[model samples]
Target: MSAVMITRKVRKWEKLPGKNTFCCDGRVMMARQKGVFYLTLFLIVGTCSLFFAFECPYLAVHLSPTIPVFAIVLFLFVLAMLLRTSFSDPGVLPRALQEEATFIEMEIEAANGNVPAGQRPPPRIRNVQINNQIVKLKYCYTCKIFRPPRASHCSICDNCVDRFDHHCPWVGNCVGKRNYRYFYLFTLSLSLLTIYIFTFDIVHVVMRSVDNGFLNTLKETPGTVLEVLVCFFTLWSVVGLTGFHTYLLSLNQTTNEDIKGSWSGKNRVQNPYSHKNIIKNCCEVLCGPTYPSVLDRRGLTQEDLPVPVASAAPSSSSSSSSPVPQTTHAVLCLQKTKAPLIPNKRTPDDAKPSIAASAQKSPSPKEENPPAPKAPPLASPEMDVETSINKDKTH
Candidate 1:
């Protein structure tokens, strides 16, 4: 229950309810924290409208034309958006898991120098490219390596993300490797909240317009100015975001995906997530426990891997398979061989060489050996010399 303990625990699939399934797609939740203001505003509108309906017959009669229907519709719309945020394909787990290995590889490359054991060299980023454009890709000076597409660094969290998504201020956390699902739900709920409140305000405005002359309506309605302002803000934001998200979703992409030119026609074949039944594949990603690697090894049960197309067969130049190898055994072998020795833990079978290296650094009797002198230590040069001189004088 403690914060430290909570941090240590990996939330369980079932017990960890409330957007536990989707962690990779940060924007799935949308803008829950930033847009919560509209939810509050809508609640106020609903409350006030109800009050007027009961207290003042004239006001109620005028407001009745639009208030109830508007309130109900708006409420439902907001509710739908909130609910949509929570729903996602649980099937993407396999793909996500597969990509995780590559991410780990990148981390490994960063840690140990590139040089092999006993060599004077270190491993370096082999190839680097920056597109020619005024909009320079944000660089990570700390990591000192060009990030792959969809990757970014969060200033607040101080870690580079694989796919940079918008930051949510409400959670006071970045929707990074761990917390993406919660963020998606947050945005979905907020959009609904905005739509609902906007609807309610619109109805209330219309009803007021009918009750009083158009010019007088402004004076008659309570909080008319506030209502108008909130309504404009909500409609503009919700409409714009919903439209943009629809396009991204249809293309089987996230905000990060869209920005990185992952869908650019020039490299369409190279995009790992591209394939037929993409919607189904993406749904699985959102809902499933295991995710595919970027290499497209289906993380689901073996039965779930997509069958290749026969008629729409890729051109001989294109392979329908993932751009990366399913499992890079070569890299794995190198990693196994290169693992660092941890103190106090039993050395792994692969780390025998590392242990031997340490052993070689210690002093041994053979290494300490020195040439022996022929004479004994007590047989000093001074004694020998004095004896020889006394012998000569005696003679």
Candidate 2:
């Protein structure tokens, strides 16, 4: 008899190590480490920005005295927004909500009926019907909940973030529901600052060239050159980011949802979330509406989204039908089932009738047979005989 290894599938809702807590402690620690890097960058950028705006001789000589003050104030505002975006909690699901989800999950599981001990529960697909159309929402096994529309599990943060944009390594945080407005503001402000600095640098350089020869201007105003180069290099990313967010705001879409192609289909030219008014969509994102508030504004509830439903029961004409493909989770569960310990001694011809009989049997919810015990690999007669011989020799 070959050894059978039976491994049970761990349900996501079940309390497990590293998953039971609302906040993943390890991820928090890593975020803190990344925070330090971002802070360092911010400080360095701030120092350079201030120095070039005020201390650079060409800028001081040519630019109006009020320009530096305006630039500094704008720079500070940008920094403040950046800090808020980086440190603010990015809409982690509340403990109360988690409890609610768990309760709902239990009810769903019960309604589906108890799965046999060795078998996996069928995949529960949840969906919402809107205007006679079905929209699907993904389930996160790690969070043990169906993610809301526009929400996604950030692998870096190890949390499901509502209205997830993307994790900004430069900001050292996720731009999500609560802080996306701040993130957008930060990007916009930074872009304006770069353009402001770049503009003044160009003016200073041009003025200096007319007064002092071009080569002499370059040599004399090296700080101006450095500032120009820095702003020039960084402007594209800052401007592009701001522009991309603007487009997203106009359409009322998150970076994740947009990239996943969830909003586009043959049935509609515009996404449901898009309010049809660009100004209204922009206000919704920039004003920092809560998830429920956003949902309410759109006349939707959390449950309004679609999720995968549990598969229908097999039909009575079982023997004639082809087998359905199993879900990923179910396939994994089937793969982990224990092998029969005692090899079938019966010939293939003898086993054919039994296989056919089992196939003909219809599945029933009322059936509750306990899983049979798996035999150990050592239970084979040859292994047993060898074990006995070895014991006798030792004695």
- What 10-residue stretch in candidate 2 is worst by lDDT? 293-302
Question: Model 1: residues >4 Å from true position, as ranges?
Answer: 1-151, 168-172, 176-189, 263-269, 290-395
Best prediction by lDDT: 2
**Candidate 2, residues 1-395: lDDT per residue as tens digits?**
23434445432322222221222322221243375546646654764565554445445556566766787788788878887776666765532256777797887788899788999877766787654456667777776777776678887767777878887878777788888888899889888978887887778778778988899988986777777777787889889989999998898888887776776755554576777799999988887545431211112222222444556546676644756666965877655652222224354766777655654564333345866576765455867788999999999
Worst 10 residues of 1 by lDDT: 87-96
In model 1, state the lDDT of residue 291: 31
TM-score of each: 0.40, 0.59
Q: 1-395 in candidate 1: lDDT tens per residue?
A: 11221123222321221222334433232232334535444554564454345323443465455554554565555445334333322122211233665675677567764757787544333343334222224334444435554566555434455545544443333443333443454455556555654555556566667757666866665565565576566657656765675555445556765665655757453444434465765464355453322312213221222444445446664654636463786787755555434333354767787677765665344446885565654655777899999999999
TM-score of 1: 0.40
Model 2 alpha-carbon drift over 4 Å, by segment? 1-63, 95-105, 113-122, 129-133, 266-270, 288-395
What is the clash tally of candidate 2? 9
